[model samples]
Target: MIDTTRLLSGHREGSTLPPLSLDVTKPGNWVVFGPELTAAAGPWGMSFSANLTPDETTGIGSWTEDVFIKTLRTGKHLGMDTGRSILPPMPWYEDLKAVFAYLHSLPPVKNQVPGPVPPDQVMKMLSTQ
Candidate 1:
């Protein structure tokens, strides 16, 4: 879970993260997420906005607060040995307990995010300079 206020503020201000073209000024768009990108595109691939809802089978329902903090602090998926490093556009260094608390407060939603795949050399060449 991310602190939407901070993340959106960064986006709005054009901070280090990639610029978000989405118009955040519109009412009710605060919940609006993104257009998912594939990892095969390269290190810069921007995956879809995660299903922050706590569905046990699909979302973060099973994750503990420690894992959440570890994920942000270390940028590793699952915040453990078995997962991959957290990808780009996620400012994993900034861990906000309020974000995790908010996530915990939400009703679980079963949204199965697509698994990321490794990029081939061709895609690597095409997407990156």
Candidate 2:
């Protein structure tokens, strides 16, 4: 027997990981050729996951496909232009083929990624349990 209430409760708290600041997902919870998405959001440590949307401030809500391609392909957010590096588990160089292919196949929805994981806080995140 499925405990509907318990299941729902689990979702409320167990929906994401233990280290992000916000929850970033597209409508329908469907990611085309998605990148690295931890089960739960990380704690609001020194850094948080970018919304990964196209929004100006909160999301990647204003980028071009070409730019997006480079960001993931090189794992250098904005391709060295921004002079910042995306954190680990982004799978930019690792699983890019699928990420690119899937993203290309999905509808271009404007979502915003939250703030970034500051360099100072990056190491702490790695050591966090």
Candidate 3:
């Protein structure tokens, strides 16, 4: 049975470092994507996935449909021009009305994910670990 505990919560655990070689045999060395959409680190540094739940404080509870669509289309946080870039691996898509509806339907999960870490600070963060 699949555990829905952390589903769509983006919960995951492991080293952020890329594997030394392209060895798919080692599952522990790879980064796994959870239903909750957690964090990912690469040459671009660490980026924590945002909580898509309808929680007003931590998630997108306060976001309007227009804001959601614009964020996807423009890749800007809250779809604002002055907001930070949404970062990589987040593909820009069109027509998210249905997607937004479905997301709002789910139970709101209060998960405050960490902010994106710049490339320059990534190594330093790793070194201290």
Kindly give the number of clashing pairs for every candidate. 0, 28, 6
RMSD of each: 17.7, 17.4, 16.0
Ranking according to lDDT, highest score first? 3, 1, 2
**Residues 1-129, candidate 1, lDDT per residue (tens digit)?**
566543322222222344553454344443323322211122344444444457676567888999877877788888897788776556676658878988999999999985665656657665776
Question: What TM-scores do the predictions have?
Answer: 0.39, 0.37, 0.49
lDDT assessment of candidate 1: 0.56
Model 3: residues with Cα > 4 Å off, grouped in runs:
11-37, 93-129
The better-scoring model by lDDT among 1 and 2 is: 1
Best by TM-score: 3
- Writing each residue's lDDT as its tens digit, candidate 3 over 1-91 gives 5456655444344425444333422544554433334655444444667667787887788999999988988989899999988864566
Task: Output the worst ten-in-a-row residue range by lDDT, candidate 1.
Answer: 32-41
Winning model by lDDT: 3
User: Which consecutive 10 residues in model 3 have the weakest lDDT in total?
Assistant: 17-26
Clashes of 3: 6
Model 2 RMSD vs true structure = 17.4
